[model samples]
Target: MTLFSREVELLQLEQDPDPGVVVFAFDLETNGMTTRCDILQIGVKGFNWSTDEGFVQEFNQYVTPTNEIPQHSSRVHHLARDEDGDLVKETDTPGNHEKLETLPIKAALTNMWEWLLKDNPPVLLVGFNNSRFDNHIILHHSKICCEPDLMDRVRSRVHFTDLRTVLSQRGEQGNLESHYNSCDGPPLELHDAISDCTAICWVLNGKAVSYDELRGRAVSLESVLQKKNKSSHPLLIGKLVTPKVAEKIGFITRENYLKFSEEELIRFLKTKGVTKISITLCVKKWRAVSYEADF
Candidate 1:
């Protein structure tokens, strides 16, 4: 093939565009992992792939759950249905039905939908654990908050991107885990809406973690933990799936990662799933960490 042809082929494999585009980073903390789960918080981060603008905001509210949030859930998330709970500050946002500062779920959802639709966006929705959980909650809450048709319109018009699944697929052992428990940081402390939003924002805009640094840490940890081998997982997990394309194996979209030539495949394998932790600890991190942030 000619040089131009070769350049085009390589470009086809890249996920992020050069400039002038943005991605909407999304996350939701829920009461459970099932369809019956209640969404306690919605975290949104907007990242510009082009201009590199990123910002996060939380629309947290107390919901009268159809089912109770389990005690373990309360322990992990502290989302008890307390009449006096600080999930929302009365002065920050007040409404009888657990709305954020001034906007109820429906209104907050509208802001999202409009932001997405009106932006003339070459944008997509992103969530850490969004595929199975965040998307469901967004669909559910949108329906409850607005008409079914409106929700359908949002679903049809807006593209949903799941960062967790992609990160997981690229995992050394097929799972990328967030290390929020140890000395490392994942913005887990606030346990409140705003903090998680910040974390998600940092992640999508490519500000959250780095592989070069993590690899250095992994090498050090191996020496301290007395392990013979350092975990190889962090070196594999990356931004595998792209909303710009169709995903095949969770994060590695069918459009390209699966179609990579042997050369590109090697680069992708080395670069795709290389997260910030070792494979051994990555799995534990995934299992131990509770899913936070709502899409």
Candidate 2:
């Protein structure tokens, strides 16, 4: 739904008004971070910006993959091949595939956006590591699962926040593996989606924050990308728009764009059919993700 004063008010009630009107925090477990990866499940929590405290909502589903769920994925989530498992599993078996109706998850997500709108409030999407991966998965999978176009359409005005960015912005490094070591408490296991997500949430337990990578910010997208490159060995494609930029642009799966040649960039840019000037302005934002740029 669109963000308006009244909508924002109702959202605030749901999220306890952490800062804006409503902020919904969620966590997701997937086979991987690609359109190729199956969306195993999703867990969501909505909070009010004004109050900081919040209520919870959740949606979890298993997908009928067009591809196989890798063994590596199975190890991370600790998802069992059978029921009563500690984590959710990706099954290609006949019976597991027939578990749900047209949409494996009927009540959860399809009706969630509407339920949040019932209050007519502006909602912020918060997640342990979303705003990038999870959000992309939800959008891509919704399409894959043949859900309403309205689901992805809501991106225009959904308030979004992610603890991962906060950690990165705070200059924290290392995978989730490192976070566990630095903490005074126990280490967080990585492949377990909900557990890993909950650990990230612990990082933002007391604060409510929001950010937009596209909008105006103190860090130019280029500069932020460079720092990311300098931190690593600089993979072959890393020289292009840097992994950081790629991730920010919502293609975290691609190592980097540097490996792509100018011809590739041009061919990519050319692939788009001619469109109106107004539409061009919006599509132009993707110029970085859609093409080549490097030091």
Candidate 3:
């Protein structure tokens, strides 16, 4: 039920206290919704929370995915594209994506990771809907690049913050554009990573208002995403399970399943002959549901 979790064992800021908490907000544009999906671009911005100061460093890059950009995906961001299939920018026109010199998938992810850790004290990784989407995409690509442990390494280096959770906890709908519109904030660029990152920073800055306010609610990034548990069945879904036994039984699939709260997950594990369990994320319901199988 809590929003943020910080790991004290990973705290690098204790020795150097003056700069205050660091937040590195970033965004990702990807090709699709599945685990093996491609990431088209990334944008990052770093700032000091106490003084609300952004560091001189910012990162933006378009990446060439192994797969060509799908038409539906391209429609979301509207990046400049040519017959040669390269992303490009218009020389004298407005509303066109900047010139599309792009890095390879591995290079882009590595570069973004390096830039985030450039500071002496590590920066927290913050993202909009990161737990559900961005983090997984990053992880999948990291694995493809043969750096299977990259995300775990990052998690160990700094805390991860989810802007969506904070917004929802404060009773606002967790959509980035909706929040931006309500504040009369600038129009979001929709799927452009840099523009979206900037918009998120604006929204978070407006809501956080003070470092103490954010730090109090910050949670560990490792605790936010999918966790593995021992069971004969695969438990393959990506969302967290609610903690309790279900009042009713439901069908299960490779891509979908029920969920349990932390307590519920434990109880389900204890059930006799319970051989399988699945965790499902209901985007419409905005919560993870636990599905159990007594096979």
**Predicted model with the maximum TM-score:** 3
Q: After superposition, how far is residue 104 of candidate 1 from its true place, in Å?
A: 4.4
Error of 3 at 184 (Å): 3.7
Residue 272 CA displacement from its true place in model 1, Å? 42
Candidate lDDT scores, in order, read 0.44, 0.43, 0.59
* Stretches > 4 Å off in candidate 3: 1-6, 9-19, 50-56, 89-99, 146-153, 209-225, 228-295
TM-score for each of the candidates: 0.49, 0.50, 0.64
- Global fold similarity of model 3 (TM-score): 0.64
Candidate 3 lDDT over 1-295, as tens digits, reads: 2111224444424433245555777888877877577777888876664444344357998887567667687777765456676775444355555567898888888777766755534456677888777776775566467364555456546555678777777677758887766656655566788877777767766665344444445444334434312231223332233323232332232112232223344454456334465544343355654454433
Question: Candidates ranked by lDDT, best first?
Answer: 3, 1, 2
Off by over 4 Å in 2: 1-22, 47-67, 80-108, 111-118, 128-132, 144-149, 176-190, 206-295
lDDT of 1 by residue, 33-146 (tens): 765466666666655444433553334443335456566775555555545433432222333333233345577676666666673433356655555456656765675787
The model with the greater TM-score, 2 or 3, is 3
